[model samples]
Target: MHNGFMRVTALALGIAGALAMGNAHASGFQIRENSVKNLGRANSGTAVAKHDASVVSNNPAAMVNFDRSAVQVDMTDINLDASFTGGGTTAIGTPLSGGNGGDPGSATLVPAISAVFPLSGAFDKVTVGVSVDAPFGLKTEYDPQWVGRYNAIKSDVKTVDLNLSSAIAVTDRFSIGAGLILQRADVTLTNAIDYGTAICTASVPGNLGASVANCLNPAYPFRPQANDGNVEVSGKDTSLGWRIGLQWKPTDHLTIGASHRSEIDHNLTGKADFTAPSAVAAVLGPRVADQSINAPLTTPSVSTISVEYDFNDAFRLMADYQATDWHSLQSVKIFTGGGGVLGNEPFQWKDTSFYSLGGEWDLSPAWTLRAGIAKDESPTNDTYRTPRLPDKNRKIFSLGATWNVSDAISVDAAYMRINVDDPTINGATSSSGSHLTGTFKAHADLFGVAAQFKF
Candidate 1:
């Protein structure tokens, strides 16, 4: 009973915080864009040399032949369509409720940025550069009155990375390079509805039947029940982390590159709010609850190996393989009032691998064309999968082009389509018997443009 009470208390506090923050948010903080064509192919820019910026994304040493120092800027935009399908209507009871669970709206409008530069003539054989990028992040939002509101309303996981690197040409036939990285990240997690108030209301004399019956099935539950959706939690956190990389060029026609990016750990500190009707509050302890917590953010390390072939001056091909040590994110830890622990849930993620292939074709003196493809794996498991993070393995196809507008300037544009397979999450009852199960599907589209300047 004590454990149950403690869990209930934790749930109550969590819900209160979410409500105060305004429900309907999600978090899966993973950013997937760094370059235009590269993004079209699952972000595989490590072994290709199509432009001066390529030196920064792949190997700094590739700059050994740059006639002059340069700068590159890229902007990427994204749109998405996500939904919950194949489930009957139902209600839940925690804070207070009278609604059904079905469809949660999809998320959209993501942006990513990056910049790079070279050292000097004194180090003609070497190049130094820096770039800012996001490797992991996501955004999910549900309706305010949706059954899943209590589980997640608005979720945003984002990050900022700053990297410093040096690339050197050991010989005309070989180039080696390395890098040091620093990163800062922030996360906002929001949950809606109040289960405590809903549970108490359901326990009243004549309300036990609906609660008992719905608790037995896994589809959905109506209000005035222990698990009848009425709880919400919302908060934010920020912290610091770092990574490293290396590259090798064995010949003018072949460039082989390898790199490693370390994990980013953020300690999120923020406030929460809770709201319930008076009747519900009488049983839940209050009509309003407010407090703060420290949430932890984990960004994993990635190791990659890739090879690019310059078949001739007008054509090139590249392929890469990357392993992300997602296992580093095993669980979520939040600190609450009096510096004590509030919630500690297992993330239970494992390492994931990615594969990519790309090709560039010089169509004429003034135009270049590019195409690529790749596969990306998800890090979340079925048991832990929530509406906020309905992630699954996905396939990507991309197309891009560059127009040489002048002797010192070039413009680039690229497009990508991501196909996300339907993802599923099996239901499990809390010790209190609040059952849950869901089938989720989602996908995204992206457009990117950039300007390359040489002096």
Candidate 2:
């Protein structure tokens, strides 16, 4: 009974800690599709561009550039294509049977909204704004009987952030701002469990006598993938963080801005449900029963510096650099409701950086054209990469346009293409001693549109 409990706990915690972690459209599962204008320029100058209400989420200090109350609504569609080609897969030194998982990526739609209000009366020097957006999300599902099913079958995570910010113009050339962030996240993960391997590895005597020979016997009821089980974990949490930013206009045509957002820590509590074969369940008994679990997760902090140069009324140039503190997510530790530590899964992710260059051309009194390019570094490396996060460095290209229907209303549209470097999985081993080896070819396309209204 003791051995059965330990096995169950390890499998439960392993899936809960590792598989439930991260994966998304952006590097390290972070989402950057908060504004269509920013997307048009590959996110360049996001912190310094004081042109729209989206500034409320990128850099609150930019709000000082607005004098009127305005609102913006945006919608973005992300289409991802991720496919795996199997080289070789093995389970407990034996070749595993199953085809390569089909394309696991899916198309998703993301929405964002923001409003900025410039104060009057005694508070005329202050500008306040509010924004709601999804900063992180992920979705992937592989075939149930795929060779890598033991590693991960399906993973879904979503997050929502609400920001309230205020900015004050300290002087004609300088402005400072601060904001409070409230974020909520939820995750659901599922994976296949090799019951044959579990029963063979168990130390408890009786039944089949806990031997590999018995497990591999043709007549045995439990043999490798022949009698597989399943486990699912679902969790949710909410947390708070803060951000600060500043913008400086050294000259009439030059602007520089910097911003930092703190990391939010979440303590997620949920249930782990298990389904085992009848024969396996009869032996494991209550050990395979459902139970409550908890884990701790910390989202990374981000810092950005942007510069914008307005050469003339019709032309503008911008560039920016961003850094993410992904090293903070070294490992995920699972715990029981009574505070007992189950185990931990190590990620050992490194910090990542992003760079972009963009420009805008005023084609006509009512039209503007935008173009940009960017490079994004991946935090995961070959040594620690897994099927759950087959991340690689990527390059991005974007084009956009804005139409000023009138002074009170405008529309913006943008398109982006991302090319991800092909990644190889040398021999990612699962908790059940399954090794998945393969190469992944991946890419993504994004389309966005936004409408702005002034009151």
Candidate 3:
């Protein structure tokens, strides 16, 4: 084979080994932690509300609401509580052993920042802004010896985004905006494998090429010699995307806004590390060598419509409906440049929608309180639930307050609790002769704070 083809084949292992784990969370790994104010409103009005510069990330057109240069910084702390129950998680080789895969989720933090500046001279009607934050990620870990270890042990994926946007008001009541997005992504995943199950692929006597059913099959001669091995993969990639938004006000107390974000395509390059037990390595060492890998992924796109209405001077309400195009990850295929088939995972994910309603209370000249509720649906199905991500339909309840110390300095804080429905996983088939099954109970708490300064 040519040197270039060989190099690509070597890297293909990582993608085949870890892609499942990397793209298994939040209805296929989507995140919404851009603003503390939005969090307080269950992300409602993100496309129209202009509480701070953070609006630049969701709806640049809303930046026209600001008259001066401003900077906003926000941070959110997440605490996840998740665990698996049920049975039939036994691996192929190891006797049915280990405990429930403790907490499958991790406590993590997400941060976001944005700055907006008004135009001058001839550009007086235009506003420009920049935003930085993470858009997608999940971190889940399990005991190395857990019953589901053969399926997943640790899975992590993260993405960072930088956006530059500009907006112009075409009329007193209408505005248009667009932004260019630059994003970087990284992933790592680990899992155990059954050596005996892998041997079924060998062209030897008593081998079952396509119907290998672990050591339980009487057709196998050395089922007792089965041993467990491990595979680890890590990779990174960068991609570009775009977003556009519009804002309109037909009445004094009501504003209508909409935004759409394009999807980013990523081609990641990385390496896979295989650690085989002595018995298995003696014969399969060459096939299990560390190799360079490539994984192709397309992040989801989103379209959101928001409405902000003021009942009177002291109360304002905002509602939103957002649709996510999770169909981008409909299925996944992994293979080497040399025509070697590593694995193919069938996702058949469905598109999902989120609905939110929030109300803001203006208590005093400097104090404002906010509250909201949201319903977030999951795209995953029971037939394909995996240990890497036990996602399900969820509800979010939130509360928040803003304290304006002065006209130029204000701080916002919000709290949210997420409740997830308990979902059951009907057995899911893995490579060779492995199948994994279980049920998951998951929930989380989020706390966010943001500081805004108008210059």
- Top lDDT hit: 2
lDDT by residue (102-152, candidate 2, tens digit) is: 877777788999999999999999999999998877677888988888777
- In candidate 2, list every pair of residues with a backbone clash: none
lDDT tens digits, residues 1-455, model 3? 01111121212222222322222223446778888998888888888886768778788888888889999999988777877775553334334456887876666788999999989899988999999988787666788877767667877777899999999988889999999999998888777665555564344333435333535666654342256777776678988999999999999999999999998888766766777777556655476677766667778889989999999998999999989987877655554535454555566678999999999999997999999999988877887665555577888899999999999999999998888888776775444245556677777888999999998
Q: What 10-residue stretch in candidate 2 is worst by lDDT?
A: 5-14
- Candidate 3: give its CA RMSD in angstroms: 4.5
Q: After superposition, how far is residue 228 of candidate 2 from its true place, in Å?
A: 1.0
Q: What is the lDDT of residue 113 in candidate 2?
A: 98
Residue-by-residue lDDT tens digits, candidate 1, 226-253: 3322333444444444434445666778
Per-candidate TM vs. native? Answer: 0.80, 0.94, 0.90
Q: How displaced is residue 101 in candidate 3, in Å?
A: 1.2
Stretches of model 2 off by over 4 angstroms after superposition: 1-24, 87-91, 205-208
Collision count of model 3? 6
Full ranking by lDDT: 2, 3, 1
Best by TM-score: 2
Greater-TM-score candidate between 2 and 3 = 2
